[model samples]
Target: MTLTNRQRAVPPSMFADETLMELPPPVRLTGIGLRFYVDDEGRGSATPALIRGQLWPLDTAVTDATIREHLRALVKVGYIETYSINGRKLLALTDWPSVDRGSRSRLPAPPSTEPLARSSRASRETFAVEGGGEEGREDGREEGAGEGGRGPSRDARDETEPSPFCRKHQPHGTDFACGGCASARKRHDQWLRAEAEAEAEGLAE
Candidate 1:
């Protein structure tokens, strides 16, 4: 992938540095490949790259196959996922999936983000009052944790995963209103509605 202005700031030491001088060339290639996902910009980006112009005089001699070799190793390790876009092979750091930095942090996974904590609690309360277990327990744990600040804190985790109030644990699909939409909507439902909404909005524009 090509380096963006932001990614260009990365130092060559993060990629091709003295650590290579100590290892056999093949091992060094593997090290660089392993680091593909660890580099700050790479970890924070869907597309990560070696700055074409920034690597240094020592980096010029590297071959495309060698880079690809390293990339393959990284792919095997779940460091990044390699795919082709527009017929050119591109690398995405799956460890840090989003291209948006506003969405990334050091957490193992994103935190639960429920839009309306009170509403989830109300739902949980109703579920409990109506003799529901799975729905109320799951929602209550989420809502209560959210309300009491017991769940993963914003400062402590990413906010891009399934919400803590996910209704999937509810005993029956009938429990949640079919027409209601939440950011935490049942997995397939959210995707369907959002896809349709995006399509509609695109057509409107």
Candidate 2:
């Protein structure tokens, strides 16, 4: 397997995650180890034999059956998701934290599901920060902004422009407010709320 110089971050909240704590020790360890193996897009091969080879090459006791059981447990708790593309099984870290200065993955994305405000690319661009998780700069400014007086950066301008369409809400024009879009946004808000609650629980502990 080819490897890159990408750096990955483990959120502190991970240790306090109740669901993860309920998993068996070996399965939990395997889940954590798999995070390091995923590409920038948080995806990797899911075949049990291949996963065993990649994750436990020198450990004779770690059989392919053990790897498969661990994968099943991780999938059960939604720590990771497994899918197939063109008959090749693959796995993606469901909530993998973003890495700074990471290169884009060459791996194919998992099949599309309900469109969320935090699209796959957007999720990959966001990193967890102390106090709370926020995207881009804290002051609501794009990175690399010049001090001298200037108009909004290209990125800022692009953000202002309306998105044409997304996977689930496709074919809708810029002026249309499709129900699918609204439902996706609602689900995204719920996800944000859950994340905030999780973070708060971790902080309290």
Q: In model 2, how large is the Cα lDDT of residue 179?
A: 26
lDDT of 2 by residue, 1-205 (tens): 4433444556665676556667888887788778777887788989888777766778898898899899987776556778888898899877655666666877677654333334422432342222133553446543433232122233432343333333444555234433234333444555555445433433454
| Top candidate (lDDT) | 2
Candidate 1: residue pairs that collide: 111-158
What 10-residue stretch in candidate 1 is worst by lDDT?
107-116
lDDT of 1 by residue, 1-205 (tens): 3223333222353342222233455644544443433344334222323422223225655555555565555444333455543555445443232344533444222112223344333543453466445653464554333334234333222233343232433333333322112223443344344444433433454
Assess each prediction's global lDDT (C-alpha) against the native.
Answer: 0.38, 0.60
Candidate 1, residue 148: Cα displacement in angstroms equals 41
Q: In model 1, what lDDT does residue 129 have?
A: 60
Off by over 4 Å in 1: 1-57, 97-205
Backbone clash pairs for candidate 2 read none
Candidate 2's C-alpha runs over 4 A off are 1-6, 112-205
lDDT of 1 at 12: 50
